[model samples]
Target: MTGIDPAVRHLTRTAAQMRKKKPMRIMLLAHSYWPEHSPPQRRWTTLIREFRKAGWDIDVVTPVAHFPQGRRRLPRSEAGTPFRGQRGPFGERIKRVPYLRHSGNRHAARLVDQVFSAAMSIPTALMWRKADVVIATAPSLPILVAGYLVARLRGVPLVVEMRDAWPDLARDARLVKGQVKSVVERVVEAIQRRADLVVTVTDGFAQTLRARGVKNVVTVTNGLDLEAVQLLEAPPAERDKLEVLYLGNHGESQRLDVIVKASALVGGDLMHLHMVGHGTRRPDLLKLAGALNAPVTFHPPLYGADLIARYRSADTCVVSLRDDWKSFETTIPSKTYEVLAIGRHMTAIVRGEAARIVTEAGGGDVVAWKPEAVAELWAELARDRGRLTAGLSGRDWVKANADFRQLAVQYMGHLSDLVVAGRSRP
Candidate 1:
């Protein structure tokens, strides 16, 4: 008995044929792009670059840069005149759409940025010509709306890639309410329905979209680029003490307080939790660590090779998703993949699909966002070094399956089929 899903088998066969004849020509629209330093931007970079390598002529429509580094990427300056345009390594054109500001904690600020980026994309995509396909990547749902309209105008097929679910996620988080949120959700749903193909990051999310009436959805798990990750050397373990590292943003959604509480509960050389990253909640988390006298170390963001090396210092990698159920179906922290790439056992203190990934990958253990549970797990792992080492077998599982190369190939195959179908249509 062949265990492959029929839909996937068919799509795979179709994509293989499309690749041999001619590579795809694709225009990807996202609010952020490479060097902006967000997980979504990182994912797009890997996929787009891989597609370009496979002979896809790619063009990325994105906003002017400014992100996790907290600095505006100045337009390239040559002598006195600024270099207004730059193309990606594989000759993919980069079209910078004007945007208002960087990320923000305030809804108004976030809306302003999202709207500006989307508005800028309208002209950007309209003026960009000769692409066989357009992919609207999301979280900024406005981009999907713009992609759909542009594709409709150009008579091209529009593919929507959902990185996060919108208004409902916002509603569940109590970020907004009343008529406006209701309206935004309806708009998002309409766009989802209109897209010819929808790419979801997880099966759980796809299921949610299905229940909400979205059709033609496919799951593409977030994965690590082991090629780049290999540049990082695993650090030598320091001692008998367990070093649990949490890498990525220290924002509110992480529910890091639980980790702090858990550490306080354990309170010994047996456990040490290090959080490495910058976020709005860092100061508060730092203060809480001090007040609680938890054995927590805070480090600033590290980039690429350096970041990987820094992460190697830990015996186990840790990630915490928000305790909010609203987050379960909508988000999967990309750090989980990074942890696997680094060959570290993961300790995820949250719920939903991420927990499932950890469990299935044999990557690590999952516990509810409870101090006692987290502490118990920490103590158990800390006492059992051999177990932690054995648990890292999941890293091998991820490398073979969830690594970026495999993911990129899958994505390009899907995009190729969409392009072929678009080209075939009357």
Candidate 2:
């Protein structure tokens, strides 16, 4: 018999070992889940699919589909409504709980709804009697409390995944202040202390958590799900006019107003700016674009293949940040990875860690937030489009470093170790 390929052999052994061991029952607590096109939902959906394939029993407890935009009723099956129990892909189960749908633009109103939803999720999570481990993801930090209580009650490990630094981001955005900021910080820290594993999406976030005395922190940066994004053949470097695109959340941190101001400052027939995706700031941005008479088009959000096509059509992908916000320095937008995966050049109006990544990766130019600076860069790129077309190398870099399959494998190993450790504890 010929020897098997090393990779195949390793996979075979791993599969057999997984089958031999008791199947891990994992409960995921998030305020959002699949069918909501938000980043947290998409990230966890991909992770849950991989976990199910790896022979784990996955149960997701989330609020009904309502985010960025308000809730829409989805079709239900004869078996039951999705709110009761929905069978997700690969036999993974999802349980949607009740929550008030608040408008995204009002921060205080949104927080109230999230806190109420988080409280409702605790009882729903307790219903999953088979769960051996629990993971709580936070853009909504209240869910971490639910996960902590569930884990404590069931004698299982609680894994807290920080997609953003929560109250820090809120404070930086001026959504929280003074005593409110201190109280929020205390609550977030207390939740962090309860977790057996603290997973952060950025190294900067992990460092911040460590400084705040959180233990067992690990950085698992957001990456491209290579399987989902079908990279198309690169269009010619030469085009009739430049098309600059900014896709993904248009929230407070994005500072998309800078992009609009830049478009107005650089008013010419040579280039047009496109902003896609729905968020609290979309209406304000639309109004700004109109007031400035900028050559900017706003498109409603697209998903799956339609979103990929939009990326493929772009001459350059623009990423923006509010320069005044210190917390934003730590956020490496997931869109960065997506743009690189689609082999598109990036122009980032950012600083600190995000700028460092764009610069070091050779993905594209990192410009200051000033309209004059951005206009100048756009003019240069319009003249020599090759500067914006040199993204094949960036694509290669992403494939090598940020493939989701590899990250999923590493994540599973981490979770398995946590399970073993939890089992041994008194």
State the TM-score for model 1. Answer: 0.88
Write one digit per residue (lDDT tens) for candidate 2, span 143-234.
Answer: 88888888888878889998987768877777778897888788878888878999988888889889988879888778867767766666
Q: What does each candidate score in C-alpha RMSD?
A: 4.2, 2.7
Model 2 error, position 111 (Å) = 1.5
Model number with the top TM-score: 2
True-structure RMSD for candidate 2 = 2.7
| C-alpha lDDT score of every prediction, in listed order | 0.74, 0.80
* Candidate 2 structure, TM-score to reference: 0.93
Clashing pairs for model 2 are none
Give the C-alpha lDDT of model 1: 0.74
Per-residue lDDT for 226 in model 2? Answer: 78
